[model samples]
Target: MQVIKKLKDFRTLELLQKANELTLKNHSNEITLERAIFLSWWCEKGDCAFCYMSTQKPRISDPKKARRQINSILAEAELCRRMGWNIEFLSGGYGSFSTSEIKSISQDIFKITKQPVWLNIGITNDLEEYGEEISGITGAIEIANPELHDKICPSKSLEDITNMLEVAGDLGFKKAITIILGLGETPDDLEYLFNLINDLKIHRVTFYSLNPHKDTIFETQPQPASLYYAGVVAATRIMFPELEIVCGTWIDNLANIGPLIMSGANGLTKFPLFKMFGTRYGKRVEEEVYWSGRKLKGTFTDFNSLKNGADLGELNPFIKRYIDKCLNKKPLKE
Candidate 1:
């Protein structure tokens, strides 16, 4: 309604700004981080036709090395816990790991800090495998774009994923479904998927933009326009007002984020790509946005840390320059 009428009246930027303001009013001013820790066999078998690791570049990381990485990420999680971040997430590639291996890793992470562990790995074959022991475990059925997903992740098709989602839902876990935009999906297809997830009572939704991955089949494919992406975000917001919407920065970057932020996006799939070390910005923006909003700070400072709210206004000066050069925008003067 509001979005549809406004769509015809205002330019893309104006619509986006209004959406951003509306979202900001409803969310907190603090940013949280979500981190990905790829376990062994991370990208070994099921490489997306668009991911760098999927190409002929190199084999997956060694199991021992992957463990070390997880330990390092856990240490960062400790830092986030001490700072009182909004939330922390740990997810990775496939369900290729043994049940014991997955459980042990989940337990170790649970021991370190009490941050919510949103599993973005492959769907497990058995729910009994992840029982009451793994209490903080949240289930995510990522990549629901059937045909495109088959092209990228052939092993896990739409039917296989749907079955897993049912299992996860029945196990009394918080279930999330992810849909990657820009795979040539029709508006009707997108709407159907969103409504289907909602009907199933799955309350969390994540949207990602499709970009070229080194060595993937669609490496030369162009990304969708940012304004178009914003409209999709807005539509999703209106349809599922209570759904936890997470937008990934790895794909959206800075240029398109303003619009998505306004489109009632409450969760951000944060990573080093956005300069946030390991936090996921969920339904919140950084207070430092008041400033120049340029450099990507790994962590967030307390809202009360600044003297006046105005003191937080100056953002990192280079943010706009980065967006212009990167993302789907025309380059500006250097």
Candidate 2:
């Protein structure tokens, strides 16, 4: 096992290359792409320093609007199913609703979609209350270090996050966690974070690069280097060989995708399938405005094409060497 003591060590391409080899050895060639829907941007606690939604207006008592939003989400889920993506994920801004509300929404969405669903509806103290209603739970512990987590996300405690994960695991739900890179956390901090995940037996992890929103507190902070982000992905693969490493393609640009996949990510998440299909959800102003200042646009193949054995049109050449080497298969020329 590779032991990295410094953050800079993760920036080394050679280390990333070695980690990529290890990832191929453990997991096969196929990359998994999962679909997700943003249920709501309303957070009740509203104290996370790094999130743009943290300072948004509180959730108003408007049942009509809420119902419309639910209908729109279901419509989007139906489109995703037609597109050949069956695993649907439902997520929202943290503390947006009560645990009971989340359960109700999950049950409704599951019933309407009739598909496997993963819930990322923020921290719920009683996750086991849902029982088999949810296929999995994503407990996002953005930063692992207690001090950093406290400083960055004051709304929730690390203890609470761990408790949620433990409860989800005990309930036999497929457990996953999301970790944001470049949140002022160190290599030791990451080591500590993964240790906790291993202890909790959480096997699936998603990594997001910190893309600061304009009005958020973290906006003034320097953006994380792309290479540094890729390094962290590679390092995570090296540290947890058996764990599934997922890259958040929504947060990073197209150029970084190759390096991220080559480094060790076996799955992609948070893709904008609805946006690609030209579905307008009416909340676009609020949603697009937050990610506006940053250059979030990029060119990538749709999930359906990749699922049907079609090569990534423009991206295949750049990543083919790594994919070929990892899969031990012949290379294809563009």
- TM-score of every candidate relative to the true structure: 0.70, 0.75
Q: lDDT by residue for model 1 over 198-260, one digit each (tens)?
A: 767776677778766756666677876776677767766665655667676553355556556
* Residue-by-residue lDDT tens digits, candidate 2, 1-334: 3545534555458767777788878987655555667767666666777887665655455423433255455544544444445453677775555678767777765765575578887777677578556888888788867888888888777788778878887788878888887778876676787687788888788888777776777888776777877877877777788888877754336456667777787766665543433222212321332232212121122323223333434433533432232234222222
Clashing pairs in 2: none
> What ranges in model 1 sit over 4 Å off?
1-31, 56-70, 83-88, 132-145, 273-334
lDDT of each: 0.53, 0.64
Q: State the lDDT at 55 in candidate 1.
A: 52
Number of residue pairs clashing in candidate 2, backbone atoms closer than 3 angstroms, sequence gap of 3 or more or interchain: 0
Error of model 1, residue 108, in angstroms: 2.4
The CA lDDT at 21 in model 2 is 85
Candidate 2 accuracy as TM-score? 0.75
